[model samples]
Target: MAAEISSDLLARFAAIVGAKYAISDINDQQPYLKEWRDRYHGRTPLVLLPGSVEEVSAILKLADETGTSIVPQGGNTGLVGGQVPHATGNELLVSLKRLDKVRAADPDSNTLDVEAGVTLQRVQEAADGVGRFFPLSLPSEGSCTIGGNIGTNAGGTGVIAYGNTRDLILGLEVVLPGGRIWHGMRHLRKDNTGYDLRNLFIGAEGTLGIVTAAVVKIFPKPRSVGTAFIGVDSPADALNLLHEARANGGGTVTAFELMPRLGIDFVVRHVSDARDPIAEKYPWYVLLEVSTQSEEGVGDALEGMLMAAYEKGYAGDAVIASSLEQAADFWRLREQLSETQKFEGGSIKHDVSVPIRLVPAFLDKAIAAVEAFIPGCRPLPFGHLGDGNIHFNVSQPVGGDKKEFLAKWEATNEVVHAIVAEFHGSISAEHGIGQAKRALLPGVKDPVEMEMMRAIKATLDPKGIMNPGKVL
Candidate 1:
């Protein structure tokens, strides 16, 4: 055990949940310490599994009284290190897995009240069970929890239509620094009572408070769905196709994903049963889906849009999925793009966003810059082109030392992020600024904006016991 945590202190905290729930053994704590990408590893003297909101409140209350730092984790699938504790072993790790429960499901109101530990897939299932749809569809939905999604304001393929997590959530139940519970879970569409408090914690990433439960909005299930994979000449061509789809899709264009041939190559090589949707290889590809309430013309609308785009020289080749299985197959290729990159070697990832119109220009400049900086590196730039969130990932050169290439993570970020700044893009788009980008936050954020954020942090967490060394 670390010198900072006394035996008495550990036991005192353990007693709140139970001896069985408080995990102090290093082996048991290992899973909660390291992030998925292995980018950040931390150490904690104790990991508390809080089963109830009262237990979480009690833990935070005691931590506040003793000036102990607390790191709250949900699902342990965070790409960034925000959920992990620090290496000093002075902080306490609070896992919300035990809090998993669907508190309420009101199909009439089109909302579900769930605890923070509920997996995103479970939320979707709950919505589907009630003949509704919760459209936050991330590749990690099977493991990532609702709290983590709201904590990061996660965006996925459905963002073009349904919006980010912030837009999907109606209200939140938060536990403040001193163990005070803020019961702000309202199920109203338009509430003009006072200041919007839920928005503050939506993307705060557990620094302000722990989201115990939430009321999330759900939409009517689409009556019909149309999926298509199209080959494009470049990012510019994809943008043109997106414009045409938007004008003709009648607001049914739910997803417009931009992927490169390199990403497709990686997926097809690494994933079993994965194959290219298009017969011919193109510089870029688009995975477009149209979902609508009207089943009559959904397929025809999508086909008409694609046909018009093809005639206008926007799409080179296209394949409209005729069956549900084929559509799932196409989605599998897009979803596996990130996981398959590991097979090639080290990958430096950048999640950035710019104005919709500036995407092509930004991609051209950033890709050229990264390629020039690291010769022979494979850049796999792909993501939601409609919403302007690009996952600009670069794999290490063939037969290159993984460690040597990963050592350039910071330098590569500087090169790419500099171009992002030129296009007025955000350095961190859907992913929150965890430990990975904490230092870089200042350079990208405006001075006044940084000052305001710091002030908010100080006011909410004066002792700085809530998730230290994160966000602000």
Candidate 2:
């Protein structure tokens, strides 16, 4: 049970954080109480903006003593409503935006110790300043924080090379529910000391504890990057191109993204300054990237791969980016796809992943199922093909009522997820199971695995005071 906040408890919280940092007025707390996607809007008794880890610990300690629930929020750009609090207005919203800092960076060790509140874009800039690269690239990197990325184990275009946020983390600094801080900020390449605790909190979604800081791995900056926008006959051909690129590109393949013709048309029509690169449209398109340490012969290698693909009828048309501006332009077309789809009215989106070889079958079956539900519903299937994760999204039919279309969210999700289950794929790929997917967890998770997760939750959060009613 959640405890009600009294005037006395609010006064104590205000004393820990300054009076200005502690907000209780509904108007003052409006921004922090809502989520980025506008899907979750809640009421909170108090919003606490702690400036330091010590302040966070003190606040958590006070909340623990008072039996008050605490909800941790970072950047507030999460898609699944994980960073928002419940609607009951009983939990205390703890915003870590003030704790943004880069504690240290050692290029020799290829690691950087950064605070959780640091934005993903800022981390990338910091790494670039030190002549290194932080390869966690997401569409919302400008607004999403390192804490939320680590919490969700976010994957983006770089996953084909650098892996997910969990893979990039070498150590962490977390504050547990009882207000005790765990300082495990080591940058060792190999530390075989018992079980790995750092991996535990990477995708926990702030259920077990709050991530205060982290020591993340970095890589040497690539001297050259080759980008291409290719038109493929189908998703199967895109996969074939990916395999060929890996074999002939000599380990330089970094990203392989798939986009359907409808998705590209949406971006070109809705997104500003977006245009099609190819003279003619194809059923499916692929944006492939290769990064190398040597500047010479990288473009030649990419061209050679595409030429071979064309000879085998795998590629219909292709365009290799010749300059840095051209490369950015090619990526811009891919990155703006999600935003462009918003103008098409209500949409049902599923972020799922399957085995690499099963992607074609998954796409074929998912689209067929969706069409069976509502014909001509404009299926916009696109995402990281190399990782077998696709952002399978459905836009409302042209001239359809948005409310009536969105009313079938549950039905649409069932149709898509059933196909995903048939292929033995995950319903939630990079996004964590926040409040949005809490109800669906039991349906997909095995009975024994669900019990084990509950056991861990009970052990770490005995009082159930951390992010109540989220993820399990």
TM-score of each model, in listed order: 0.98, 0.98
* Best-performing candidate as measured by lDDT: 1
Give the clashing pairs for model 2: none
lDDT of 2 by residue, 1-472 (tens): 5767898888999899999999889998888877756789988888999999899899888877888898999888888888899888888999988889999999999999999999999999999999999999998899889998998999999898889998999999999888999999989999999989898788888988899999999899999889999999999999899999998864478999999999899989987788899998899999999989996888899889899999998887899998989989889989988888889898888899999899999999999889889776988989999999999999999999989988988899999999898899998998889988899999999999999889988998898888888889
272-325 per-residue lDDT for model 1 (tens digits): 899888779999999999887886787788888888998999998898899999
Clashes of each: 0, 0
Q: What is the C-alpha lDDT of each candidate?
A: 0.92, 0.90
Please state the error at residue 309 of candidate 2 in Å. Answer: 0.3
For model 2, where is the 10-residue window of minimal lDDT? 30-39
The segments of candidate 2 whose C-alpha lies over 4 angstroms from its true place after superposition are: none
